[model samples]
Target: MMCLKTMMVCSLRQQILPILGLLLIIECIISLKLLELRVPSHVPLGTRAELSCSWQLGEHDVLYSVKWYKDGREFFRHVPRDLEPRRKFPLPGVDVETFDTSGGNVTLSPAVLETGGRYRCEVSGERPLFPTVSDHADMLVVVLPDHGPMISGFRSRYRTGDRVQVNCTSGRSRPATQLAWYINGEPAPASAVQSAIDKKTEDLETTSMALDFVVQETDFKKNGLKIKCLATLAPVYWRSNEESALKEKAISNQLLRSSLEDVKVTRADRVLANSAEFTNSWRHVVLLLCSMPNLFLRGLVWFPFFLQEI
Candidate 1:
């Protein structure tokens, strides 16, 4: 009975060791396998985006499949030995053609605003006695604005004391646009700003703002006052443009001349009254001189007559 038990223990040990050795070898092979995924941290809207998948495995191991998922939904699949070597599944709001995906790489043609989300790639390898060795990588896809905002709606010239209105519009962009204003490189007054959504298309929106204020004399002090509009589509993407409004000194001067004309008229009226009074006094003096000459000649003639009478 002791010898039978020893034989049974030896058989069990022999079987278990081989199985353990195979498992260890499989683990070692899997340790050699490497799966790499590459993609940009952020993709700009209306641009092509690429998601790359590459791998390295043991010499005898075969690449079973490569799959791509977005937000946990499969969008691309590849298999070496299959009726269809590559297959593309439908993903809403993504425009991908067969030509866009090739050799474990998926390309998005004109990546859209809503296409941004979580992306994952799975790679699988087949090795003898190993239940499909697989690895996956997760990445976050953020969509950024393709371009900066566009500014418009302010005239080239402004007069002092004139009311001016300016509007700045940002180009269509994913995510709401934030707008700000600067005048002569200083923050604009909040009371002068009014913002609204200019347009909307699906998830993309265009935003604009109106800056209305009365042009002060100080605004015309500079040769050209710069009013800049900054439109921020995302924290990473922003655009700014400055519009120059030249000081219309000609207009200001005209207004100043008009104001001075009234003062000039009042001064002219006082000078005219003083001139009339002086003319009357001079006329009286002239009349006295003429009478004195006549009286002196008459007195001389009367004196001769009196002598003759005496």
Candidate 2:
């Protein structure tokens, strides 16, 4: 019975030995992953670039050292040995123009194209083996285009008393649209409006704004009688375009009066219709007192009452 118990204990230890060995290796890998690096991260074309790297090993080591590298080149290495056999660090690889190890963060200014590359951070411990490493991020550059809102509608001449429409149209614009009306080069107040038309199809545009207003005589005579509909696209897609589109027209007093006269004369020229109003207006009542001098004084032709009524 004692031999059986001893055999079981030895078998259990044999199984645990391999598991413990694997656990130790996993612990080492986890410790390496815990040590991290920091970098300024991104870069853009035609602009300065910066990279950074850092690691923290709590109260135990006092964060012994930090290093910065680009591609396979070493730029800077930092280490503090004052604390107990804590950490040993090596300088960065080549390929960098300057190795700045004097500051907490490795800063690269007045940057250039070559400054844009992968940055690596390596950390070491005076007592521990295998350096902890990580890489910073890469960046991209972008280009932009001129974009804005377009003006449409309100293209033709409109006279006083005429119903007219104006629209602010656009595409590829950012923010929103700015629409206004100008009369004779002066800003006109925005009036009550109708719903904007926004249709973005292969055959249609993205957005359209409309304003409907009645015209008046003053809108035609003075101020040169010019009207303009303007659209200023928002900054996101719109570059600046400082020109006002101009449309002009003239309304003469003669034209307005002639139009009214044509309406009157045409009505006056029509043949009278057979209606009650027509009968009342065109029906002329006649009262002729028949006291002809040729007839005897006060003498009258004898006529039946019915004929007199007729």
Q: Of the candidates shown, which would achieve the greatest TM-score relative to the real structure?
A: 1
For residue 85, model 1's alpha carbon misses the true position, in angstroms, by 2.7
Tens digits of per-residue lDDT for model 1 on 218-276?
A: 76545777788887644357778888878876546778898799789989999999999
- Number of colliding residue pairs in model 2: 8
List TM-score per model, in order: 0.51, 0.36
Model 1 Cα displacement at 189 (Å)?
10
* TM-score computed on alpha carbons, candidate 1: 0.51
Candidate 2, TM-score vs. the true structure?
A: 0.36
C-alpha lDDT score of every prediction, in listed order: 0.72, 0.50
lDDT of 2 by residue, 112-195 (tens): 445555667666543453435455554322112224544455544555566656665555222234455565566655673555
Runs of candidate 2 exceeding 4 Å displacement: 1-7, 31-48, 54-65, 81-104, 124-133, 139-310
At residue 214, give the lDDT of candidate 1.
Answer: 90
Error of 2 at 125 (Å): 5.2
